[model samples]
Each structure stands twice: as structure tokens, then as C-alpha cells.
Target: MSTNTPAPVGSSGKGASLARMGVFTLAMINVSAIVSLRGLPAEATYGLSSAFYYIFAAIFFLIPVSLVAAELTTGWPQKGGVFRWVGEAFGTRLGFLAIWLQWIESTIWFPTVLTFAAVSLAFIGPDQRWDEAVSANKWYVLAIVLAVYWSATLLNFKGMRTSAGITKWGTMIGTVIPGALLIVFGLIYWGSGNKVDINMAPGNFFPDLTNFNNIVLAASIFLFYAGMEMSAVHVKDVKNPGRNYPMAILIASLITVGIFVLGTLAIGYIIPEAQINLVQSLLIAFDKFFTIFHITWLGPVMAVCLACGVLAQVVAWVGGPSKGLLQVGYAGYLPRAMQKTNKKGVQTGILFIQGGIVTILSVMFVIMPSVQSAYQIISQLTIILYLIMYMLMFAAGIALRHKEPNVPRTFRIPGGKHFGMWLVAGVGLLGSVIAFLFSFVPPDQISVGSPTLYVVILLLGAVIFAGIPFLIYAMKKPSWKNTDSANEFEPFNWELKKTNTETSAPAPEQQH
Candidate 1:
């Protein structure tokens, strides 16, 4: 049976073929992956020593993930992005799970970041006691964050044109400016001969091989660097993805790692680990670092900038994954309500649902003793979901070689097909497994939650979230395929059509 459902189309009519993206745009996206490196309150506790783990993570985790994504993305530059790539390699059910996990994780992370932004701003308010009160109040923090987050969501509802405008300009104003300011402030502080605690010495910059715990810490921090591939979803929009994709990933990786190495060093120089506000450490570093340099005026300026950056981060995430999952939903994996889009091309329902999820998770903060504990728990759950997505990606990449042997590939991994498959799939599988295992280990700096609770929360999160896709798959019924529906939203169009003449004549020989 042919279902005549019109496929939901995203901006149709291909724009001009993209030329190679230069270092600037590449750096912008890369910065998106690494900007969260600042403050890193968790890392600060091990003294200046944890910076080494970050460097290691940049090497083993971040770069390889980017490379794997570049290959997959260059091969299949389609609307669905990761969901399509993985679904093509695996089946639709698994693909739905990939996007679902990605979308869900972002929802969980929204509150933690907002709280971090709130805490950062609170420090600058007059009266330390009042500052403490505002920072500690869960309801107040939730209200402020929800307000900012929902506003950004509304802006995104205006469509990609508006969202892209904000993202492009916001990245510059929010991230690059603040980052450059940090570097400039650090130089000024050093030139003035102020005593700085964190060592920027050449030897300290190198990875410490002897410390196993620090190695694990780097592995933990490395997970934060996991989103490089997420930006690659836009590779098709880049002028010439083949060359530009690799170039972008390479340049972005270096710039991102450099910023992280330098930024962390600067933070360490200014503050001791014990005094670090793991929640708002980056702003804390700015406050203290600016004070030491006698540039108190810059402190509040940086704080506002940091808050805007966090807000922009929330805005970008609020729309991005939901957009991906909306693709899956409209394709019949989800109900029709999820398919609804307003005039601005936003899935308002999904946005509202995401906010609701975040609001629910925000309540967890009240039960949890500390913001860091709640933040870590939520982030860990996100990591678990992310790992499941990565595992599917790896499997899909490998499956494609066998299933579509002659499919045109613009940018194949350098090795022979088998070698390439093994390398990409193997590394992805290993890194994801390691990341999942490490997700349960409580951070060393603070006792945010008990080990028993942490393990249970993480395990339950992974199982329950990951199980949703399977349930959907089991509910699916086979139907006639529609060639026109190759990338359409309806799965009923996916069933192959049968001809009446062939059906009538089919059993003649068997009867004789």
C-alpha cells in the first residue's frame, strides 16, 4: 500500500555549492566544542596538574571523534545529519534512538548550565550574604534560567535565518571576545609581576604519564570535548565539505585545545583549588584575575559576557537537537503532534516539551545537596546517552561499506575500506565504552552524591532512555515502500510496492 504522505521538507533548493570553509568558521565551530573548558572547577582541585589530562583527552578522544564524523558526514550530506547517517547504516529504529538520545541529553544539561550562569552572575552582586542567598536558592535560579532559556527558544522559533544570525554574531561577541580578554588580562597580570599560583612553565604544559588518576581525570574532561561531530552536521552547508570538512576539524581541534590549555593555565595561576567555585569557577577566575591586575571594571564586563555566552550555548542546543529529532518524529517514528512546525519553522511543541523536561530535572537540584552534585549527575546521564549514540554511529559507518559497496564517497578515510572501517569503528567503539564506564565514577574534588546513588542514577538513566527506541521499533508494522519517500518522514512509504500482474501470475508454476 502506497501512503501518499508528503514528506516534511527543510529548506529546499540547494544553495550555491559551498567553497572550502576557511579557518575562521572552522574555529568558530571548534570553539563551540571547547568553550566550556574554562573554570573547570572539577579539574582545579588536583591543582594545576589536571591540565595534563585535558591535553591527553584532546589527543585520544576529541581529534579521532572529529575525524570519524568528517568521514561519515562527507559521505552522506543529508538533512537528517547523524540520524540519517546512522539510520542508513543501521535501520530506522536505531537511527531514531541515536537522535533521541542526543535530544534527551541536551534537555538534561539545560538546567545545570543555567544554574552555572546564575551562580556566576550572583558573585558580582553587592552584599556577599545576598549573593550567597541568591546562589543557593533553587527556585530563584530555576525561574531566572527558564526565563532566559525560553526566550532563546522563542528567538529560534523565528527560523534558521534568525537563529543562524544570532549564533554567528553571538559566537563572536560571547565567546571570542571573552576568550581574547582572558588572554590579554593574563599577559597584563604577568607583565606587572603579580604572583600567580598556576604554573605556565613549559614542563608543566606536557602530559603527566605517572599519574593514573589524572589520566582518568583527563578522560573525564575529554567527554566535555565530545561535541565536535555535532557541528559537522552543518558540513553540507559549508561551501566544499570534502576539503573544508577535514580542514575545519583540524583547525578547530588545534585552536580549541590551545584555548583550553592556555585558559586552564590562566585560571590555575589566579586561584587555589580549594577556593574554586566548581559551579562558577570561570567567572570566579575572571573576578580574581581581573582584580589582581587592578582592572576591576573588567570583572563585571566579563561576567555579563560569560552569562551571555552561557545563554547562547543554551539557545544553540535548545533548537539544534530538537530539530534533528523532529526530523525523526515527522518521519513517523513519533506522533503527529511532534511534527507540527509554526510559521518560523520551529517545532514549538518539542521546544515546550524540552523545557518541561528541564524543569522537571531542575527539581532534582532541590533534593540533591549541592548544585555540583546535581550538575554532575545530569551530565553523567547525558554522557551515557551520548555514548549509545556514538556506538550506533560507529556501527553504522562500518555497515555502510558492506551494504552499499559502490556508493559514492567524497571523502573516504585514508586507509583501505576494511582498514578504514576497523579504524573508525574500533576507535569510536572503544572511546564510547571507556566514556560510559568513567561516567559512573564520582569526581574526586567534592562529595556531591554517594557512590550507590550515582551508579543507580546513571544505570537507570542509560537503560530507560535507551529503551524508548526499542519500544517504538516493536510497535512498528511493515508496509509498502515508496521510492519517492526515500528520505520522507513516513515509514509506511518505506515498504516496497508489489504489482498486481506479478502477484496474480506468481503461483502458477508452483500449482503444476
Candidate 2:
């Protein structure tokens, strides 16, 4: 198959055309994928300094990833996402590793987000104490997580059309509406002269840099901005991607930061720092705000909305990285069994395998000492795994500048020569490396049981998950490749170059 073929276009019965997406739609897609209200409460505990973390992460992680991905996606515009970009830069082995981390980090991340969904569902009940009790119950959390996750996986089986619709509505009702409401309530509270819990002092806006413990939770901010790269896959779909992608990123970043900062401040305004619970704080903040507004009845409605948002987020993620991995599998990286697709062309086998992993991880709720600890541990693992991929991605961005200088880029980072690529991607790489190292330090805010266990789990988990792609690459058989020429994955550029060089080399001197 031709590697450089433009993305397929259509306008007929067998292949109805997809309308090209514009800036607003793409921006909202990025918003839906990256903005999770649940994280606000944790950051809220940082008071004014939360804004610092938000801005820092946006600059170092969010913007860099989005810009780098835009360049890469537009330049390649191929079936594989990171797999294609990194493969072109480094080679297929590291390329597979990048996509593997993307998929697996997201896979491990399912339980933590679902756990938040379970908590939101728990709060739908009348009694707050009863809600807390149910939320804390490992069995209930596991049951809800599995039910919601598997349900989403099954729904995705229908195809992207069904999934996209849910994400759009889910994000509106669940994320945008709730965030706006929280900010409005905070405004009303401040306007009404109720005391603000967070210090507005100028000095408090920046976090204390000296304390390592103080900065440990900041590592997770990278995760808060993690999935922006996922949206880059659609760079080809956007009109004038060079212009539109950056506009979308700018608009989406501002809106996202606004929602996060205001939402966190709203929660901090209502719930005291001591009372912030990672899973329940967002819901609790909503409940408290509604109580003050004398709209206690809206509490359950907010719970349902947030839960829907979480479900929508899950549905989006469930299909996304798996689709990329499926393309790689079709290219002969995975065993033949993994490449199976359903009637709708969904990756049924891979989706089921993903679900199975989620199911196994959800079971950890039962074995861990507490649901919160389990959530923290899984979240940290996700962050570290994803950071490794980001490191590879940033390095790949810089390397590609040198390796394929003449490749036409619709958009390029600003500086001349390697300077722009290095500055943007270099900062991202440095930030990711710092976060990855800091991720090993357990936050003192929670009782993670044993520091030794936490370190061991993270180190081992990263090793095993990151190492699997290499093992798969080693075991890959030529027979595993899809025989259909149309569906075949394009070989890496390096592979083609090596072939050309070998073929052009002068014949070896005769032996005698």
C-alpha cells in the first residue's frame, strides 16, 4: 500500500461523504476530550496556586503536544497516529512503543475515571452519608465501573457516528453546563459578599517551589492535558489545518483553563480544603452550591450530568487509541487474532481485549486498602506511562526536523531551522521527564499504604507496559500481516530509504 496516499475522500452510497469539520467543532472535540471536571477539586485544594499549575501545564504540556501533533498529523495524514509519526522519526519498534503507551495508559486510566463516575452515581441518592458510604464501597465501585465501561465498549461496537453523538451531548450537559454553573454560583457567592475560602493574595498565586511534596500532585497536571494529542488525528479533517488547528487549540485552551480555574475556585469557595475528596469533591461542590441557591433538587440532576459526561469521555477514549493500535496490528505488529473487525468495521477483537483489561483493573478496587488509594495509584501509573510516550513524541518531533527536512509541512513551529522545533518540543520533553520522575514520589496528601509498594508498582508497571511492545515486535510474523493490499499499513520512511540505499549500492566486488 502507498504510504503517502492522501486520506480517502467519498461522496456516494457505498461511501457517503463526511463533511469537513471546522474550527468550532474541532475545538469542542478537544474540549470534550481534555477537560475533566473531576480534577478541579484536587487542584482547588492548592488555592490560588492552582492557576499557576494550570498555566504551567498548558504551556509546557498542552500547547506543545497540540502543536507538535498538528505538524506531525498534517505531514503524515496516515492511518496510524503516533505510531506513524514516531515510526517515521525513530523506527517501528519505538513507534509501536509510543502507540502502545498511548493505548495502555488510557486502558489503565479507565478505572480511575469510572471510579469518579461511580461516585457521581452514588451521590444521586437522597442522603449524603449514604452516598459517601456507597461511593466508598469497593464492591459497588467495581460493579459500577465494570458496568459502565463494558456498556461503553458495547456501544462503540455500533460505530463512530453513535459514539460522536454521545460525546457531543455528554460534554455539553456533563462538562460545559456543570462548569458554567459552578462558575456562576461562585460569582453569585462572591457578589453576595460571602467570604471566599481561597486566599486572593498576590503572593499565594504561585506555588512554593522548594517543597517536593507540594509539587508532586502537580505531576498529574500533565495528565489533565494528556489527550490533546488524540485530537491531532483529526488535523487532516479540519480545513486549513495549519491555521485552524492552532486557532482551535488557542480557543479550546482558554476555555479549558477558564473552566478549570473557575470551577476549582467555586469548589474551594464552598468545600473547605480539609473536606476535598478526590472522587466526591466535584459532586459535593455542586451539591453545596445548589443548597446555597435553594435548588437542592438540582443536586441529583448534576450527578447524572457528570456521570453522563464521564461515560461520554469513556466512549470517546474506548474507541480512539484502540483504533490506532488496530491499524498497527493490521500492519503486522500484533497477532492476526487482534486485527478482527465487526460488520461496522469496528475493531471488535481489540475492543473486547481492552474491555478485558479494564475488567481486571476494576477488580483492584477490591484488593486495594482503599478506593482513594487505588485511584491515586492507577492515576499515577497512567501519568507516568503517558509521559514516557510524550517524551518519545517530543523527541520524534525534533528528530523529524533533521531526518525529513524537505517534507512539506502545512504548519511549522516558528523559529528558523531546528530552533523552533527544539524550543517547543524540547520544553515538552523536559517537562515530561520531570513529571515522570516526580510521579514516583507518592503524594503525602493520601495514605498510599507503603511507599515501597508504590515505588515498586510504578517502576514495574512502567517497565512491563512499556516493554510489551518490544516483545510483540520480536514475535511478529510476516504471515500475521493483513493480505489485503487496500488495508495494508504503509511501511516506515526509514524502511523505504534503507531499501533504496541497498538497492542503489554498487554490487559487491566479485569474490575471485
Best by TM-score: 2
Could you tell me the TM-score of candidate 1?
0.85
lDDT of each: 0.67, 0.83
Which sections of candidate 2 miss by over 4 Å? Answer: 1-26, 233-247, 505-512
TM-score, predicted candidate 2 vs. hidden true structure: 0.92
Model 2 scores worst on lDDT over the 10 consecutive residues at 1-10
TM-score of each: 0.85, 0.92
* Predicted candidate 1 versus true structure: per-residue lDDT over 267-337, tens digit per residue: 66677756666676677677777666577777667666667667766666688779877776656666555
Give candidate 1's total backbone clashes.
Answer: 12
